[model samples]
Target: MVVIAKELLQYEKDYIKYYINFPKIYYKQENDKDYIKNEMIESINELVFEDIMNFMGVVEDSYNISSEEFIHINSITEFQVGYASDNIMSLAIEFSQLAGFYDISYLKGYNYDFKLKKEIILKDLFRESVDYIKILKKYIWVQAKTLLAELQKNEDESLYHIVEDNICLDEENTFYFTSEYLVLPFSSCEIDQEILNLLEFKIPFNKIYHYLSKYAIKNIVKKIVL
Candidate 1:
């Protein structure tokens, strides 16, 4: 087994009352080249810088009109390692922001194949012939309708229709994986916010075992013994 370490780099601007934290990873392997390590670190640095600049632009606009007492901003970044070995790394990074009355969060995941030195996408997990999108969409809509049923049972009738219309699978990129489950995240208002602050639907691997391609099985399921 190879040893890997994750480090958090913190940044704060007291004047704007904002702070940010992001991750940098290090590999403890004799064969690891300096250039590869440098490139990864540089990429992370660039991402962090972009995030900071984007948030600052939003803050600047809000500060122009909002009173100092009413202005408050906070950003929280966190990561979870789903699977890690000598050849593969899968993880998710969650970014949550609270600016005055606005509250938003996002989940981004990366499945990296060390041997190929490339990032994996959703389609890569399934066979080319399989209509993965249609299959995934069916399962997701089932879950959404289940939620709608519960809302109809207890919530007000008028609000139920409004919520139903907004429940949609807008993007296929909002997916990740853990050792046990395939995780999918929903936007804040995409579903009924009254039900959940963050909507993450986790489908167990056993539920979709046969849908996985050979590559996914070898790298993820077999490695995790699931």
Candidate 2:
């Protein structure tokens, strides 16, 4: 049971001035499906507004939560979707924050190694399970130049450094997958792009299918085809 103190949200002298409310973000749920789903909600509830405020030192309140100030929480389920799955292939938790025109993303995940009958702590699944670095290095220059040209055309040359920093792919790079595309999200401010939001690159699965784990390929084909 969640215990709420009488003065939980009261603005007292000793109490925290900045507090974040936990809103229901789960799109679906039920009595039996509250295992992982419940845990995800609990993790988000722990995020404090002061931590973000002190980290970014921007706003004391979340009223101006536009592109300037926002928090995005993302979770990835690698096996059967949601808490319905009896098997836990992998679970990834991601937090993206944008404050005062600066943004950052933090990801933590654990993958169940079916063969080993154990679990592997993965900093990122995309970089570990696939040859993403090789592919990115092969095509980065063209992509970089294309983005540069677009920025120059828009007369936003000041963000060139930020754009350059993101052109590379690594294990620390944040990503999640969909039916057809692998969405790599690089969260940043205007210095990284023109918006204080995530600049996502959606790459087709066919391009990197050969590099995915056999289990992933098998299950994903089923999801996309059937």
Candidate 3:
């Protein structure tokens, strides 16, 4: 089993203050533990710096008032372990802040292989020749239709077309996994709908078993059965 420790990184400046919460993962083997821990920290640091710079740009563009009229910006990052067992570990880090007239939220997912000593991407779990994007998009559409039906019950019919046009997996970080399901989390910003807060689609492993790579089948599928 992999052991995890919580670590907090805080940054403060003239108009910005934020706290980043991450995990320091460990294993029984010293070498393995050090390898995974170092890699995770390095990646997290890069993300944090990138967000800080992005926020600075937004703040500069949003406000023109003096320091006295400025509102303090506080960004908070929280992390959760979606699944961790054997050689596979999946983590989700969520960052939130108030920017301009919007509450901006971003989710970053990391799937690390302890044995491989590297982070996993979406393609890593699927067969090399499989058209995973097309397959996943089909599932997305099915879910969207169901959601549209629900919306039409109480909302205007115009939302149906809007949801259809905006729903898609534009990037890879939107996906992660648990023991029983593959999770796709789409925030309002991603779906291009101000009315929707978050739309999370949890696709069961059985639904996509045929497209899984041998490595994924052995590590994720079979391991889950036991």
Candidate 4:
């Protein structure tokens, strides 16, 4: 898919304002361009709307966000790009004016499947790995629990639940990869205050290699040495 449009999707109010730094992707595959475009647009719409719902809220309620200490909901927006030669795209919400609370931002990944000529989401990357999901959850919680203690808080247990639910080991979490690891983005509320970007939780590709699909492993293998 090629990005045919990049524009702002905006909403404004006296106290609350929201927008998405939207990138409209169009399919380029010759045979199924129309079908692919239809599917991709629908996928992007659903995903982006879900993002709005998850984030759009008043600072005084819902998330219990600190309105007194921080500014009101100025804008809920994201910047995204096709990553790794357009194999997948990564988007991260611009989290600001949240009383310096690290829990306010998130990262997401999207992909266009070459074989299927359709857009694939984060969940499709691991949908078949039920057993692997169980093991990965254990590892993530184990690591998160360690961080919680370092932060000197008893909230780690609750934080674990938050991340776990988002990570249905299916499709809820945002993730991408680098030359070495599959990166799982987390809000500081779930991990720790020290992590400020998409580099929230990096797991070595080797650790989860067995659980990934053949197609996924092909993309990952390029980044990580076996």
Candidate 5:
């Protein structure tokens, strides 16, 4: 089963804004907006939990984990971050390892029923949630960089250069690129397909598909997927 990381969910504009602004909410006691906080929490719950479930159900017949697992992971991640205090990268690495393990295990069809039990233990130990907004921001940047690299390496040979902008292109082309673009520095948001379609470059679908598959397998397997 192909598991789309929570990072991908952040590509959506609303998700990016929420994650980026969440740290500010936590820091400001005077300007605290409970409504916005609650709304952000709700959005996180829906996007991180509900969307994961939907993806798993659609892509794989069965997923080992439950919504509670996500809650537990989030809670534990927050706790670890608080405890570590100064070690944000460590916290991110730990969180990434846990997420990767969960995804890999689910794909391998191992520990199908025990996932929730494990999550329960993690959640129970969590007292204060950590500020993962910064880490998420960094992660988004990384994704954007990776996406840009992929586009550069595998885009049609006829294509000279790729340009990315906030503007949406008309659907007169073969592929309809989603508004979901990654944050910059670590990763770029421009997809090659979008460039090809917009520039009217006639690349074969099979070649594009193969290139994407190879790229995903290489990067995901080597870096994020573990």
Candidate 6:
């Protein structure tokens, strides 16, 4: 269980915005039409995997931290693949099970050691979990960059140049751009606070929160407008 400080969560958001958004903004101003489309597509593709993995990883890490038992590392590896395949429901189930294990383990640990308060252990777990999530996010971003570079090489000339240009933005700017762009839909649905809370170590179940929030909003809007 990792407890992420609110300030650190904000820092992550700021880092992403500064690193990711600057280039897209600059390129949008350049009137590079083909490049813009390709850049957007590439961004969307990268986010499709990154966002899911982040959410799932955070939940699992939180669970592990609270429990103090090394969740078989295989569980994390399985989630990475499950999420990449877009099996979000299945991912949520797996994550929740992991969280349950953490909660139960923490309780047992407290009973075994009368000196440690439950709250203290819980808080420590949360902090460690957040640290783990942050590390995983960085690793996934690196993988996305490599994949994007290879894809750009095979793409049309105009598109390749556009992506290349955007990629040239400093890391902070690029992160900023990508987080803002990809998170828009989630934010518009009014799940921004929920997402922020998950990042802040205030929430225990990110996967459930995210899936339910998004699904509920989509359904409500569909009923109202359609």
Per-model root-mean-square deviation over C-alphas = 4.1, 9.3, 4.5, 6.4, 21.0, 24.3
Which of candidates 4 and 6 reaches a greater TM-score?
Answer: 4
Error of 1 at 145 (Å): 3.1
Ranking by TM-score: 1, 3, 4, 2, 5, 6
Candidate 3 on 1-226: residue-level lDDT in tens? 5765688878776666667676666555544545343555466456655755575555545444534465666666777888888678887777666544556676767788877878788888889999887788778778878876777798654554545556666536467788677888776567655443556677777888888899888787654432
User: For candidate 6, lDDT tens digit of each residue in 1-226?
Assistant: 1111111111122111111110011112233343233343345335434643564455555545654453332122111111111111101111121222221100001100112212112122223224433432443445435644664676575232212222222212111101011110111111221111111111112322232233223311122211
Of the candidates numbered 1 and 5, which has the greater TM-score value? Answer: 1
Q: What is the lDDT of candidate 1?
A: 0.64
**For residues 47-153, what per-residue lDDT tens digits would candidate 1 score against the true structure?**
65576557557655665666676455665566677777776767776666667667667766766676776667787777778887667666677777776677678
C-alpha RMSD (angstroms) for model 2 = 9.3
Off by over 4 Å in 3: 9-19, 30-74, 99-101, 156-160, 163-165, 170-173, 222-226
RMSD of 6: 24.3
- Point out the higher-scoring one by lDDT: 2 or 6: 2
Candidate 5, residue 109: Cα displacement in angstroms equals: 30
List where candidate 5 sits over 4 angstroms from the true fold. 1-40, 61-191, 194-226
Q: What lDDT does the true structure give each of the candidates? A: 0.64, 0.41, 0.69, 0.54, 0.24, 0.24
Tell me the tens digit of each residue's lDDT in model 5 across 88-186: 000111111123234211110000111121211111211234322333334444444554576668766634333333322321211211112111111
Instruction: Give me the runs in candidate 4 sitting further than 4 Å from their true place.
Output: 4-6, 9-12, 17-20, 29-39, 42-50, 53-71, 82-103, 106-109, 112-114, 117-130, 149-174, 177-180, 187-199
Report the number of the highest-TM-score candidate.
1
User: CA shift at 139, candidate 3, in angstroms?
Assistant: 1.0
Q: Tens-digit lDDT track for model 4 on 62-155?
A: 3355445434555555654434344344444444324334335655555555445566555555537456557666777766666545544645
Please give the range of 10 consecutive residues that has the lowest summed lDDT in model 4.
Answer: 94-103
The prediction achieving the highest lDDT against the true structure is 3
